[model samples]
Target: MRRLATALLGLTLALPLQAEWVFADFEAVSGTPQAKLFPHLESAGRGNLAAGGGQLALVWEDNRDGSPQVYAALRDLGRTGFSAPRRLSTGAEAYEPVVLGLGEGRFLAAFEQDGKVVMRVFSAAAQGPLATLDAAASAQPTLAAGKVGLHAVWGRRDGRFLRLVSAPLTVDGLKPHAGAARAVDTSPAQDEQLYASLVATAGGYALAWEDRRAGHTRLLTATSSDGRKWSEPQPLNEIPRSGTARELGLGRGPGVTRVCLAGDGADTVAAVWMDKRDFLSGYDIYAGVSTDGGAGFGANEKAQDVFGAEKPQWHPAVAVTPHGVVAAWDDPRDDSPDIWLAARAGGKDWSDDFTLDGARGTGSQDNPALLWHGGRLHLAWVHRDEQGGQVRYAQARWE
Candidate 1:
C-alpha cells in the first residue's frame, strides 16, 4: 500500500509537467515612477489590461504630477517591451482605470475623475476623451465590447441603496446610446449590489456582481441580447438545500465576493471569485462556468488546492483560452501574497495550483489582470515593496 501511494503521488506530479507555463521575467508596466509613492492599479474585479489588433494596452493611476491622474502604456504584440507611460486624464483626481481593446490597434479606457466616469479612446496615432458618463456616485466601473456596441456597468449609490447601472455605446464612434444608461438589476433598495463585471458573449453581453440581498454576500449574473434589455439576475454560487439533516437556512452558508468574468467571445463564459465557505479556513478561490452565454452556470467548483487557517486568496482574474479556462489570483500561502494560477482543460477538473514564475517574492503581488491573446497569456498586477507599489507585467506561453 505504501508503494502504491508513492506511485500515485508521482503520477500526479508528472501529469502537468509537459504543459507548464513558460513565463517571462516580470517588467514594470507603470515605467519608472516619477514619485516615490506607489502607483495605483485598478481594483481586482476591474480590467486594467487589454490586447487586440497586435497591440497591448495597460492603464493605471499615478500621482507623479502631484495629483492623481490616469495613465496608459501601449506595446506592440511583436515587441518585447511597453512604451513609456502617458497620462490619459486631463485634470481632476482620477483612478480605477479600465481598458478594453477595440481591435485594429484602437483601445478604450475609462476611469473615475473627481466623481464621474470619464472615457477615452486610444490608437497608435492619437487619443482623446470619448465621453463623460453621468454616474457621479459610482464605483468599480467595468467595460465589455461586443459586435453591436460597447457595454459599461458600474455600481451607483441611490440614496441608501446601491444599484447596478448599464450604458451602451456605439461601436464606430464610441458614443453612448441615447437613453441607454439604466439600472439593470431588480434587487430591492434595502439590498446592495457592487463589484460588477461585464463580458461580451455571443450575440450579447453578460453581467455579474456581488449581491447582499440574501442577508449575506453572494454572486449573481444577468444576460442580455441587446444592451438595452437584460434578463433577470441569477445566482452563480450554489446554496445547500434545506430539509435534510444538518441543513442550514438560506443565506446561512459561506458568501461569495469580488467576482471577475471572462468569455471566449462565444458561448463559453467563466466566472471566478473569492469565497469564504470553510469556517476554519480563510477565503478560497471558486469558479463557475456557463455554456449558454451566461443564461445559466454550473455548480461552483474550488479553483485552488491549498487552504489553511489564515491563508487567504483574493483578486481572481479568469480568461478562456483555446485549450480551456484559466484562473489566476493572489494568494498568501507564502506569507506575502503571490500570483497563483490553475487551468481546466476541456471537461476535466481544475489542475493543481501553480505559482507564476517570477511572481513569488518578499513583497506582495496582487490584483492580477489576465488576457489570453495570440496564443499567449498576458498578465499584469501590482507589486508592492517597502518603497511603494508598481504595476508589473509578464506573459506566459504553454509548453
Candidate 2:
C-alpha cells in the first residue's frame, strides 16, 4: 500500500549519468588484523573519520593492550596507507571516540573516559591531553569548528534529565573557553535528551538530537547565533499538507534513534537517523534538511529506497559535498550487513541505494564514517568475521 516503488523509480532518475563513485581497495587503519579492533562508531553527532589540509585522521576503541583504550591513526591524504595506530588514553577504559581535523597535521580526539568527556590534541610528532571539557559526568561528545571557534556538545545528567550541554574552545590549543559551558536545550528537567549531532553554519551553528520528552522518542533540532543562547527545539518529522496528501507526523510508531548532522559549508544542514516508524517491520534510514540553518526543517524523507521493511538499516553517517548530500549506513538486506550509500544532488530525490563497490565481500561491514575532502570521499568502517575485527578505510572519487 505504500508508495515505495514510485519512490525508487524517482530516485533512479535523479542520479547524474556521467558521474560514478570509484573506490579504492580497503586498507587497515587499526593495523592489527588479529586483535579485536572495535572502532568507536556510536557517536552519530560526529564520526571517527576526519580530513583537512591534505591529511586524514581516524580514531577508535580497541583492546590490543588488554583493557580497552582509544587509538588513532594519521596519514597524508595523498598516501594510500595509514601510520601505525597510537594509543591516546593511558588510564580508564575509553569508548565512542570522535575525531576532528584541525588543519596543518593536527587533530582533536574526544571520547568517554572515566565517566567524563575528555579531549586530546595530537599530530604525527606530539600528543597531549587538553583540559577536561565537562566536570560532571558526560558521554557522546561531538565537535564542530566554526568561524569564531570550536563548538562541542555532549549529553550529561542534570538532576532528572539527561540534557545536552555545549562549550566553546580555543582554536590554537583546543582548550575550552573559560566559563563558556552551558545547557543547549530548553526542555524541563523531567525530559531526557541524548545522542546530539552538531554542525557549524555560516550564521552560527545547528544541532539535532533524540528527545524523549513527549512520552516517545522524537527527533528535535535547534539553532544558535552563538554557542550561549539556543532556539527552542522543533520537530523534524512534520509532514505539511500538500495538494492531495494529508498532513502526518511521527510518534505513532517505535520512534527515532542515532541522529547524525552534516552541513554544506553555508546555511544548509542535513540530519540523518534510524527511524522505526514502520511498526510492523524494521528500522529505516530517514533524513530531513534545513535550508535556513536549523531554524526550520522540511518534511522527512527516506534515505534508502529498499522496498520491503524486512531487513534493518542502522548507524547512519552523512557528508555534504559540492554536488549535494550523501548518506551511508549499515544495511543487512543482503543477509549480511554491508555499507550502503545514497545521495541527493541539487535538491533532487535521493539516488537508489548502492553498496560501496570495494566493500562487497565476506564479513559484516558496519559503523561507517564519511568525510568529503580534496574532491574525494573518505570512508572508514569496522569489518568483523570469525577471525577478528578490523578498522578499514577507503577512498572514492566521482569520475
Candidate 3:
C-alpha cells in the first residue's frame, strides 16, 4: 500500500528561472451527508486520476456509509473544485478503483469487490450500470485506453497459482472484443504474487508487472499492437543480482514495480521500482526507460536525486507528456515522509529535487498520484490526522 500522509495545508515551491511552479490551495474531496466527519469517515490516497475532453475524473475507496465503497468525483476544465462524489459500487467493500480517460467525454472505472471485478462507464453528466467483468477471484485491476481501444488486466487466482488475464474493450461502452479475455503470461510458479499495469501507446498498449517465478522479484513487460494479441513476456531490468543484500546474491532485486508510458504522441515508457542493490542505504528509486515504444529499454538509473539521504524512499508515481516526465515519491529524509518531485524535460538531465506539500514539522504527506492534464500538473494524495484520513488534491502550472 502507498504510505499515509497527514493534515491538509497549502504549500508552494520556487523553481528555477526556466520553470516556475505554483500550486493552488489543497481542497478536500471526500466525505458528505453520508460521511460522519468533515473529511470522509475513512479515506485513502491510492485513488487514480484521468483527464479528457476538458474534464478530470478521480476514483477511490471511501468508507462513508459504514462500509468501504468505491466513489468518484469530477472537475471541469477550468474549475478548482470537484463535484460531489457519486457511489459507483453497491458492495459493502470495494478496493483500488482505477479510472481511464476514454477520449471525447467517456470514462471507464473498475475495482475489486468480494474477490470479483466490477466496472462502469460514465461521463461527467451521466453514468451506466455496474457491470461485473468476472465473478471469480481477482485482484489489482488496471485499465488503459490506447489508440486501438481500452485494455484491462488483473491477477486471477487459479487454485495455488496466480495468472495474468487481459481483455480489450471499445471506448464508448467498454464492450469486450470477441475472445478478448485471455491469459497473457505463458507460465508461472505457484504462489507467485502478480499485480499488472497497462499503458497506452500509439498503435496498441504496453503491460508490466513483477513476478516471483524465478525465486526473486523481476520486472517483466510485454507489448501488444492490437490489444488482443501480446508479444512474449520479456525482462526489462537486466541488472545481475548482487549478493551484497540478503534478498539477492548477484543482481538488482526489484520489489513492487510501477510503470507508465508517455502520451501526447511521445513513444517513451518508464518503469520505476525499489531496488536493493546498494545494500547499505536501503531501497532506492531506480528506473528503466524505453525510447522506441516498448521494443527495448536502456540501462537502469537512479530516477531520483537522493544525493545525501540514507532513509528508505519508495512508492514512486510518474506522469508523462510531450513536455516532460515527472516522478514523485515519499521520502523520510526529514525524519517524516514528505512528498518530493523531480522532472526531466526533453533529453536534459532531471531537475534537482523539490518539496511538494511542504508540511514539515506539522504532518506527513505521501502516496502522490500525478496527471499531466491541460498543460498543467494535477496531483492527488491522502492526508491523515489523529481524527481520520482525507483525500486532497492540488494543481501546479509550469510557467
| TM-scores for every predicted model | 0.88, 0.89, 0.86
Residue pairs in collision within model 2 = none
Better of 2 and 3 by lDDT: 2
- Give per-residue CA lDDT, model 1, range 263-317, as digits (tens): 9889999999888775336678889988999999888888887442357888889
Model 1 scores worst on lDDT over the 10 consecutive residues at 1-10
Give the alpha carbon lDDT tens digit for every residue of 93-177 in model 2.
8778888878888888888888788888888878865557787887888888877568888888788777898888764554434
lDDT of 3 by residue, 1-399 (tens): 111222222233334346445566666666422323222211111228888988888887867767778888888868778888888888868877888787676788888887788788888778887777766787777787766766788777778866778887654364433235778765644545466767777757777777777767777888888766778878876554444554543443544355444444347876666665665777777666677667676777677774424777766777775567777777777666667777777664676666544323345567777777787888776666555666777777765
Clashing pairs in 1: none
**TM-score: which is higher, 1 or 2?**
2
Candidate maximizing TM-score: 2
Q: For model 2, what is the alpha-carbon lDDT of residue 362?
A: 81
Each model's lDDT comes to: 0.77, 0.77, 0.67
